[model samples]
Target: MRFVRYGAVGQEQPAVLDADGELRDLSGVVPDLAGGVLADLPRINPQSLPRVPGNPRIGPPVGRVGKLVCIGLNYSDHAAELGVDPPDDPVVFLKATSAIGGPNDPVIMPRGAQKVDWEVELGIVIGQRAKYVTEAQAPRQVAGYTIVNDVSERALQLERSGQWTKGKSCDSFAPMGPWLVTPDEVGDVHALDLSVDVNDARMQSGNTDRMVFTVPAIVSYLSELMTLHPGDVIATGTPPGVGMGHRPPRFLKEGDEMVLKISGLGEQRVTVRAEG
Candidate 1:
């Protein structure tokens, strides 16, 4: 099933995509899609619910996200483009939950920011608690998948003297959703294609097959280091073609537009703007 949250930010109501691809109100069936609720999504006939009147705003599929964990350079080709070798272990980092925003929301550029970049990635939404789980047991802990635009500020990320989180945790930096596609709905997660475009120009195109770390591998590995709770989101790294990898290097600016898509998870079209 494809679950969603539709309405205004903070007022988003739970919804599910019906067979006809219409949004069916799930507010009467369940609460917001988050935490323990994700582990046991009710089995319902979407057609029986009220159809959403029109195209309301779609918020991040998962609510009250506990953590936005990310894996860096998980794609071998991405590591190659950056002139580095893939790490033996997943490169883990954390993006502040405050950065979470609706997929279509505007991305705000930080003051004095330079080298803002775009990374199209596949996001894994955790369903159940996991700790020291093996790869074989990891599948049961996953609820679904979503698209993530891991926006970054290279200056603060690589030039400044701090971790990547500083450049990554700015509000509106983590645009996710459109739908939270269940594993059963998104068969073969490793084969999904993902890409990103800036202002209608294709900038990044790659597949999950190129990932140095697979989905279950990432989940299992992360569980070993920290407890994975329901509603935690893991951004499996981006593919090659980031603005930073361009010949002359490209970066986002005010008024820019971004389009991100992953095979069955759905798409995100966002506008870029300067912060007040």
Candidate 2:
């Protein structure tokens, strides 16, 4: 089941698409898509609300995102492409909770920004509170998965020479979800194919089959460091072919369009514009 949050801020509704892909309101049944309510997703009949006419403004499925954890270079080829060595353990980082944004929304390039790059990743949303969860028990803790564009400002990230958070946590930096594809629908998160495109040209592409640290390993490792709360997200990391890996480093400019997709999940097209 693909669950979503839509409409204006105060009036937003928790919704789900039925078997025929028709939107049905879930707000009356479940309060919000956050806090991992889908863990024991209650059986609600589909005919409960008015039929949705068309696609509405899709917001990030999880409301009240706590902290966003990210893994860097989990993909082997991606590490090699950037001329960096794959670490023995997960390379972890954080994006400010304020960086969250809608998946198909415009990506505003920060002013005075030189290199705003794009990374396509498989994002994981934790459903249960997990601490010291073993690899064997990791799957039981995850709520579902979604397609994510880890849109970054390279200069803010690298040129500053501080934590990656500087460039990674710009407002509207985290664009997540057209749908949160449940775990059962996305078997083996480490083996999916993910890709990104700029305009009509293919830019970055690869399969998750080559991740240095598997999904379960990452979740287990992270849990040991900090409590993994429901509504918190983890970007499983991107495959090879990011603009940063290029010699000249192809980056985004105003008016550019981005299309990103993950298997079994949906796709989103984002247009780049100068931040107002």
Candidate 3:
């Protein structure tokens, strides 16, 4: 089932896509799509719910996000593109929850931002609390998967004195979710194809199979450091073709449009705009 949250910001209601691809209101059944509601997704029947009359605005599928964990350079090609050796372990980072935005929302370029870049990543949504779980146990704890555009400002990320969070945590940086697709519905998570395009030009194209550290591995690795809770999102990093890796470094500018897509999971379209 493809689960969603619809309506205006801060007032999004839980919903799901029915067999015919119409939105079905799930507010009567569950308060919202977060925490326990996500864990209990299998118990809900989307078709039994009333259909949403029209094309309501879709918001980020999950709410009250506890954490937005990220893996850096998880794809071998991405690491290679940056002229860095692939790490033996996952390169972890945290994207502030405030960065979360609707998949199709406008990406606000921070003031004086010089190198705003786009990364199309596979987001793993945790379903159950997991601490010290093995890779074998990771799948059971996964609620689903979604698309994440891990937007970054290269100058702040690499040239600044502190951590990557300074560049990664800007508002509207993480545009996520047209739908949260359950693991069962996604089948082999390792085989999905993902890509990114800027203004209709293909920028990045790679499959999850090229990931240096697989999904289960990333989940297990993160679980050892912190308890993975339901609704917590983990961006499993992007493949090659980020703006930073380009020879001339083609970063986002005002009016630039970005489209990101992952197989099984839906797509996200974001337009770039200067911060208001």
TM-score of each: 0.98, 0.95, 0.98
Q: Note the Cα lDDT for every prediction shown.
A: 0.93, 0.85, 0.92
Model 1's C-alpha root-mean-square deviation from the true structure amounts to 0.8
Over the stretch 1-276, how does candidate 1's per-residue lDDT look in tens digits? 999998898888899999989999998988889888999987899989999997789899999999899999999999999999999989999999999999999999989887999999999999999999999999999999999899999999999897999999998999999899999989999999998989899999999999999999999999999999999999999999999999999999999999999998888999988888
Q: Candidates ranked by lDDT, best first?
A: 1, 3, 2
User: Which 10 consecutive residues of model 1 have the lowest summed lDDT?
Assistant: 27-36
Over 4 Å off in model 2, which ranges?
Answer: 9-11, 36-38, 45-49
The C-alpha RMSD of each candidate to the native structure, in angstroms, is 0.8, 1.5, 1.0
Clashing pairs in 3: none
In model 2, pairs of residues that clash are none
Task: Flag regions of model 1 displaced more than 4 Å.
Answer: none
Candidate 1, residue 115: Cα displacement in angstroms equals: 1.2
lDDT of 3 by residue, 136-173 (tens): 99888999999999999999999989999999999999
In angstroms, the error of model 3 at 61 is 1.0
Ranking by TM-score: 1, 3, 2
Best by lDDT: 1
What would you estimate as the lDDT of candidate 1?
A: 0.93
